[model samples]
Target: MTSEAAQYWENRYRERGRTWSGRVNAALEREVNGVAPGSALDLGCGEGGDALWLAHNGWSVTAVDIAPSAIAIGAAAQQPGDDIEWVVADLAEWQPPRRYDLVTASFLHSYVELPREEILRRAATAVASDGLLLIVGHAGVPHWAAHTPHEGEVVELPSPDEMLEALRLEPAEWTVLTKALVERPVTAPDGSAGTIDDSVLMLRRNPAVS
Candidate 1:
């Protein structure tokens, strides 16, 4: 992405005191609850909710986002002993330095021009052998967004099947743990309670693949 992308997000964060709920994503929290903690990577880690949750749950976390203000808010909220490495970098140009046992890209959507498919493919590749990859995203335009006009563009989100196909993982190398659309409750912009579909894909790399 260009500087416009970064500027757009930076302004969003700066304009709003806190844009997101300071809690781990619902899907991620449920899926990873019983798993053993390990090194984790959080792509597009705005405000670092998921990353902070992982760190508190014993997972070493690397949280990366394009907005420095968002990263700073999350960093400032950190408790002592939280093992989190916060990075401010655009996911379009950012590369993971090492493999991670668990990788998460929750709501990696953007209003600006974004290479969504390519970024997701790279995220899948960063998983180590026997590692897990989890992606959660809006399945379609939310009712609120559809009813109301919004600034910037509303990027169309892909279905779970489309996301899996885009990743192009070798059949023999990955196990599909989850591929489904789940409804999550949320408060709309007008403060009305509602639900939205979230395309969820969770995969585990087969162990000992050479």
Candidate 2:
């Protein structure tokens, strides 16, 4: 599915003038604000919105995404002093060469077959000791979508608890910081107001005991 997935997003980005809002995701900004800034990894970073925001907030960031065009859009937006390194690779197979202080996956949902659970488990391994793993996912169909991202596909949205189970986190080594369903407001293409439900899971990897 790698080629198919890459092509799907590449076409989507090329077809649209700007596929995503350049602004940082609201949930990410709200959740991590005022925390000590450090190295951050943004998985499936579409156009580097969150990575840019992290850079602005004094974090060295590594942002990865599958589509070259999508990341090219992000690379074009970089400024003179942004401490961000962008990578083009499928998250399903990409491995973090080093650990980070904060690893985030915002709206990592895809229209293609992605081993999301396995990918996320590997993502956790990229978190440094005492670092954070923040995942934000669509909890249900968007209020404005005529169909899901995969048109007419009956994808099941997992509950927060269900997702936690899938991550297969070792409780002795991880602490669940936040688990909740959050509502995000949105504007439909027709300028109508709507809301989307999102699942938020924030985990902190415990420091090694002496």
Model 1 per-residue lDDT tens digits across residues 1-210: 448899999999999979988899999998899899999999999998999999999999999999999999999989999999999998988999999999999998877888988999999989999999999998876566655437767776889999999998898999999999999888878888878899999999999835
Q: What TM-score quantifies how close candidate 1 is to the native fold?
A: 0.94
RMSD of 2: 1.8
Per-residue CA lDDT of model 2 for 1-210, tens digit only, reads 558778888888888857888999988998899899999999999988999999989999999999888899888998889999999998878999999999999888766777889998999999999999999888977566775245644455776787889998889999998889999898888898989888888899999999
- Candidate 2 lDDT at 159 equals 69
Instruction: Flag regions of model 1 displaced more than 4 Å.
Output: 146-152
Each prediction's Cα lDDT score? 0.92, 0.89
Clash numbers, per candidate: 0, 0
Error (Å) of candidate 2 at residue 121 is 0.4
Query: lDDT of model 1 at residue 116?
Result: 87
Worst 10 residues of 1 by lDDT: 140-149
